[model samples]
Target: MKKIAIFENQYHQVKIQFEVANKIFFNDMLEYHQFNSSQDYTPISNISEFNLVIIDISLSSNSDKDGFDLIEEILIQNNPPKILILTGNSNIKENLKKRNLPDLPILMKPIDPIDIKDNLSKLLV
Candidate 1:
């Protein structure tokens, strides 16, 4: 069994969608956690418990950092559980290119629920 954590504050739509999708597809094999802000994100004491983390580039106002900064902070904190960035901003790729950061895959907002399930399934597998 694996665990998943989703960080998104935009009305919690993406979080809810992923929760439902994962529940339907992964069943008992995957557990889900949701966070609305990066500042509120506390590293799991047992990092081994979770295997994947989905981060939204647009967290709520309470978050101390945006998606890009959160990605760096997350990497600094732990080594396991691959990270996925979900953002509505299309310019993010261009911005990252300008900074020479790794090209990361992002899930655009208003995405179909089925696509979310499929993407996660591929990652988990």
Candidate 2:
């Protein structure tokens, strides 16, 4: 089974949507690990355990780091998991360019459940 990690401050909302999408499109085959803040994903040792990571560019105000920082960290791993960015920020492209990060798949906020499943299908390929 493929594994996924979701990092989003709006945990419940994102979880519920993904759960529905998984059930309908993936037949509950995917395993999910969720984090509400950067700290929740700390130690970073387990980053390679997942097949994909879906991260929100903006996290809780209390976190010392944002998703971009997390992505940079992940990229340094020997074989990083695929990443799919989630953001409400309209300047996502600019922010990514500013950080000199590689092009990554992104899904804007208020994403439709079907879109979520579609992206997942593509990424998990």
Which 10 residues in a row give candidate 1 its minimum summed lDDT? 40-49
Give per-residue CA lDDT, model 1, range 7-122, as digits (tens): 87864565567667657776746677777887565654444456788888877778888777777666655455677778778798897677566676677877766877777777
Output the lDDT of residue 63, model 1: 86
Predicted candidate 2 versus true structure: per-residue lDDT over 1-119, tens digit per residue: 89999888887867778888889899999999988888887678679899999999988887777999989988998779999999988899899999999989998888878989889
> Where is model 2 more than 4 Å wrong at Cα?
none
Candidates in order, TM-scores: namely 0.81, 0.94
What local lDDT does model 2 show for residue 63?
73
Off by over 4 Å in 1: 44-49
lDDT of each candidate versus the true structure: 0.72, 0.88
Supply every candidate's count of residue pairs whose N, Cα or C atoms clash at under 3 angstroms.
0, 0
TM-score of 1: 0.81
